[model samples]
Target: MTLHTLNLTPHGLGERVMPLAPTLTLRNGQRWVAQHYLRYQHTVESVSALLAQIDFDAHTPLFAGQDEQGVYVQVGLIGRENYDRSNTLRVHKLVYGRKWRIDADTPTSEIIQTAFLAIKKAREHEVRELLTVRSRDGKTSAAFSNHHDLPLLAQQRDQLQAGNHRVATLDVAAAVQHQLASLRFAQRAIELVQVLELSAGRVLIDVQLGAAPLARQLEGDFPEFEQLALCVLLPAARLHELPYALMDALIEHSDRHVDETFRFRGFARFSRSNQIQAIADLSLQTRPYAHDLADVQFEQIFRANNYEVDASRAPALGEGELGRKNRQLINQYENLLGHLPRGYEQTHETKMA
Candidate 1:
């Protein structure tokens, strides 16, 4: 059915949340899938079959949530289900539910207003999917990929049968936001970490120089950067600037290179391993929250953070005594430069007098 509007309710939330973080769980999940059983019958059958057959190895997780367009996918519910932050979305303040009570015939105006308000107040948002895949036996539902092409409910003819022949569905929540996802940028920074001398067998420079942004040095004109992990998290607005950063790096030294192992996708956690390299993991998280940060310094945290909260105080640059002093210094520097001889160079400080 075409969506006329959308609504959210917290009815029956308190009780259902105790056992697990409320999702389209195995319990009563069939009820929703039954609603669309006929149209997505084959798709349901396929998913159910896979869910039935997966061999849970020693390391395989008991649960999995994936994002698929047009499918009701679950956000990440990763790790030991304590539900503090490890399994939370990192972009928007996600509103969750024990059950998604779809309000049919909701006023278009209300839907529009909800969306409008989210858009007006939001700094950034994205569309994500949430589907449930449980590991229990004799169950049906296998839609686990971030990509799928299942039939919509309107196309089905058969009715949902709960037992024996069962199917589950994906939950498409609005990835809209009520606040902005903000990151604080450091000014006049230097790259603190580098492993070029130890890796790629490159010679180190004798004179110590400040660190560099490998992207800037390379100027984004390389063959292998398409797979570079940092680019995955690079903001879309700066995509054009990627090439320049890469170009700069490439021109400096052909042999000197970057460490490609650690790429930026989302929040990462590292623990000690017997091997030299620490084992790093990116947790499956959902629904980024903004409550952790001061409203002025930051807006929204876009990635699932396992890191501790520590906000650095940014120096106020204007409208204060310190600001006035800074401005006065800059003005003096400019005036001094203007009075000096043009194109004059003090090569080895030949003569100041």
Candidate 2:
């Protein structure tokens, strides 16, 4: 007993059609045939019997006044899915349709909230996946009105921002957790280093308990305070070890230029050589001393070709005397800049030119 399968979409049962084939013509006056029906020897009588079994009348009209009996039936009625799977031999391929739209001036906060709400509603409706898309301008300088407009997603966000003064506000915990879950050991290690770097600035602050020591006093009164001490405060006590490490590194590389010094050089190089002269010009407004050499006043004197002595041959500073010595050097540098040589000014002008 061959059953009539009404295949609205190609549903194959072990390479055979299921729900049979709907031999009836569509309202658009199209006849669809099941994929399995074409694989075997088929006749009009057999097709008519299949149509009759599916309750599609052979004698009735279909669509705008087309006679159903004489209607053309394409061999692959199993619809798109089966046709796509079985018809690799065909020259022309199926062209999938996509919906495209343009939207303007949509607030990021609203978009995020709306997307969350829509996903929640779709879940409630038992739709496992409701394909949703939100689009916006991808301009690099789309001024972020609110910090919240910047997404903190682990992938989408970088670890830092700012032009001259850099800032790193990445969520370290989230990044580490994602790396751990994804089994990316190298990435996890990198994230751990980043976390350490992020927390490095606070490692030097001596967190001595105050004279009254309110934090210690509150530890007895509140359980929350004790928990905080155990979790947050106690763990940070280990940061005391970091200062020693920093001192050791400084000692080991006493003759070497430090990482921050190299960074400052890079910053200056970018300002001086690149199309970004504005950055250096702006820094001149804030911290002009940064453009000066380490000796400051001596650099000005050297540039002016005044005082033929070696500036580097200056007397070494005694212990705890660096502050006074640096101040004297800065004053000398300023005086030299004020009384610069005419030739030096000409050279400077030529460089600027």
Candidate 3:
């Protein structure tokens, strides 16, 4: 990445933010996703010092934002994760520093000057996001908000069907209400799941642990579609690895089994094509379905034995560092937002020039 000198002048072409080699720190309270992040600190005084070295008109708007509390400065970023490609501003690991909010009595000159300086400091710390400041009217001064393009999954239908695993759209709520008590603590080892997304035909979700989005999706789907189609993708190998007992239970649950268990009181609702609807009507009577399903995927991918999967027996065993990091993020999400996540903020595509 090319490191450009700051354009301190009142009017110069906007500079794009870039990345330097990222190194990880062992500090706690830091957020990690697929990898550890190198924390960069830019204190207020340090930013001011960097700005003092530059020359700019006090009234020249250096940063952008509609909120008077502070201007937004977006720096560039470099990383392998898909997240690294967008919204550098909202990401904590990419940009960390004291948020400079402008007070009502603050002078406009000071605001502009401070904003310019903040950008300089952010750049020095390897900020690579693009910032589009909007006013109370909810518009920005730029062309793009640096949002990632819509994933093909949103536009296409049934892309990842393998010859082995048949894809079925399992409603999100039905997937969530499963009594995967057997798999709860063991839930830490699997990859972080994107709710409702069909990767290889499965709508990824954490059935054992309660999902906030599940609640939100429930509110939306029931009122709207009554039966929203969500995918439960199972690879052919996972099916082959399933224990005979669990496999029999699934077949019975799906009504495909002709055994005596088919006479049980479970899934007595909804026609055969809508197992999720049947599960919903059963009030999650089919929760064991979650247990059996999660077990197969987690064990196959993480290679954890039943003992290792038990969080009580090995709290941190299956989770590994990545799980711990994600767990921290989950806690933060719960604290800041409600237990149910509204959803991720999509990048705004501006219509104005």
lDDT of each: 0.23, 0.27, 0.30
TM-score for each of the candidates: 0.15, 0.12, 0.14
Give the runs in model 3 whose Cα sits over 4 Å from its true position.
1-66, 75-148, 155-157, 160-353
lDDT of 3 by residue, 263-301 (tens): 112421223555666456544332333443355553343
Distance from true location, Cα of 254 in model 3, Å: 51
**lDDT, candidate 2, residue 156?**
59
Clashing pairs in 2: 4-20, 5-19, 5-20, 5-21, 6-19, 6-20, 6-21, 33-77, 297-332, 297-333
Error of 2 at 301 (Å): 10
TM-score of candidate 2 to 2 decimals: 0.12
Order the candidate numbers by TM-score, best to worst: 1, 3, 2
- For lDDT, candidate 2 versus 3, the one ahead is 3
Residue 139 miss distance in model 3 (angstroms): 34
